[model samples]
Target: MGELQVEKHVKYILAVEKRKDDFESVVMEHLRLNGAYWGLTTLDILGKLDAVDQDEVISWVMQCQHEDDIAGLQNEDGSFSGDMWGEVDTRFSYIAICSLALMRQLDKIDVGNAVKYIVSCKNVDGGFGCTPGAESHAGQIFCCVGALAITGSLHHVDKDLLGWWLCERQVKSGGLNGRPEKLPDVCYSWWVLSSLILIDRVHWIDKEKLAKFILDCQDKERGGISDRPDDAVDVFHTYFGVAGLSLLEYPGLKPIDPAYALPVSVVSKVILGK
Candidate 1:
């Protein structure tokens, strides 16, 4: 496979944001805030974050959250809902923490309660679920573990056990699947790889093969990446593909913090106060 189409991928992400009437954009309207974060994070990883208006983007995020949509939406159990309706998930908890951490405002919410809620979602098998008593999933594990890491609470995680579970997500194809017996997908590269890195078990997976797997999913001529090879490319998979490459220490790409899911430069400046 050829190299990552960095310029093409950047163009694809920027174009998606402009094409408001497109299927992806329209359907993802309710998740506008999170979409902004993902897209911007992707751009940041590509070293093109300054291509957009930072002030305008910050203003837009503030406008999206009010009394209901984000703030005060945390449940009594300390988990967060994706929106005002209040459906809780560790995914939302991660998004909430990541977003707030980016804004330098993690203090606005009950961080203590959020950590407790995330810990409660941990399964005995050393994985995290979407919620308490739910089945462990790689995606949810990433979310919960990421939240805990950002809050400086890795002491709550059983690293050896969770690392074993995460490392097992890798399949024969060199790509990672979200759960056992599932076909490997490019998206899980970011989820699983990041989780493994956070828990210090990234060496458990075959990095070279994984790098090739993500590269093979790229649409060589058109840019963007798909969930798997010979499949339709989408912005979601494209972001993960590039991010996964970053995690693999791919040449010519920025390093991303596994826990924060942002560029090391940005994270150092914003979260780490460097």
Candidate 2:
């Protein structure tokens, strides 16, 4: 089952390569930093970074920058633009930073403007929103925290309030939600837990229940993970499933540094500031 699942993921990667022009077409069609980041990061995680031209990728990602400081923009409709057509959101910003850092283009980013954009996303609740004036969500908070961490500006966030918001995500099912009144899901387990780890307050939540919920979301027979128990499995949830387990220090699973939210093997080199 495990090998088959691995093969499925491998085929996804191969498909991305076999249709490189199509992939690039989609990327260019969006032409946003975050979208470019998503494409590059997906390739990077798959060990296919060389499949795309580093310089072209770097240049395209750079085009999404507003000056050197801010990395994303608002779409014409103002709905949280990205390389897609919407206003900027914290999640994409996180992806953009990580993608650039992974590509070793950290030096080219305008740290200050990026910080400004991150700061702008902060809400009165002490947590961050996807965009200015939006409600605070666990996912967006992760992006905000992650972007700041990459740029060495994590201190700009209000940790106490952010921690409180993250802890509130835990529900009776041992799962976490992205926002208030949302259903518990496995993906948020990583989003919320990683945020807690970032602020060193993971202990405030129910760890045992959270871990159980995550495990239950795994497709033991299929060797992948779903957003919730009995849900359809996909790559996004599968990656987060492994990530959440790593956050809990699960035995036999690789550890993930919540601060960088990448596998320890990859995050360690990033932390070394290389």
Candidate 3:
């Protein structure tokens, strides 16, 4: 029942960014672009985005793209690879597009083809997968749906059917899982909840119970959230936990756009060209 330690969470995120050579950073180096989005979005939601140097962060983001590792990761079909190994996934497409869009550099990619590829991953169940014919999963669904939303291609989604599927992820625990028959995790709070809101089906699930689940996972002592209560905490879950609360209209927190996963203010400036 304790309050969210906004300052402590902010410090944790900042510390993660500052320790460039740490074990966690080393492991996250492969997807630093996505990590940046998560951290930056969390900061903005907490109303502390100005704490970092905008120009410096944007420069690093651009460099992360142009570097030989991530460059040319895009396939002919518009799918993106996570690294030089060239494994394509809808998740990469979402991360890359989101990062560039936030930096006001969407012109750098073939957005039309990107949308086309995501559409290719659509399933008859009104859900999307990592690639064509892959079974629909909540995590992949979020990435695909989010990318489509950012690009104004939401018309591609079948709101009712998809909403039904996403809403079904909620279990008796009031927590949501990535797919049926799986244990609900706190991270899905963002994935499932955001997808429902985007499709206008949020009312299908029990928001009150879900909020309580996320709150229970918070480490009131250490100031971060975990995937489940009484478990170890990390920055990733911490961001999702807070973002989920933001979606739930928790007081004292900035509103987060379900699709872009960024603060309403930052999304407006970056995507709306305001």
> Mind giving the per-residue lDDT tens digits that candidate 2 earns over 38-111?
34443445454577678976775566655533233423332223454444677767766776676677666565
Model 1 earns a TM-score of 0.89
Model 2: residues >4 Å from true position, as ranges? Answer: 1-81, 84-87, 270-274
Weakest 10 consecutive residues of candidate 1 by summed lDDT: 64-73
lDDT of 3 by residue, 1-274 (tens): 4467788888877877888898878988887776787788888888988988889999998775554533266788989998877788999999888877777777778899999999999999999899999999999999999999889989989999999999999998789999879988899999999999988899999998998899888877657788998998877898899999999998889998898887887678866777
Order candidates by TM-score, high to low. Answer: 1, 3, 2
Model 1, 1-274: lDDT tens digits are 4588888888877877788887867888987776687788889888888888899989888886566435467888898998867788889999898888888888889999999999999999999999899999999999998999899998899999999888888887799999999999998999999988888889988999899999999888777889999999877788888899999988888999898887898789986689
- Superposed on all Cα atoms, model 2 deviates from the true structure by an RMSD in Å of 6.5
TM-score, per-candidate, Cα-based: 0.89, 0.70, 0.85
Q: Over 4 Å off in model 3, which ranges?
A: 15-36, 50-73, 103-110
| lDDT of model number 1 | 0.87
What TM-score does candidate 2 get on C-alpha atoms? 0.70
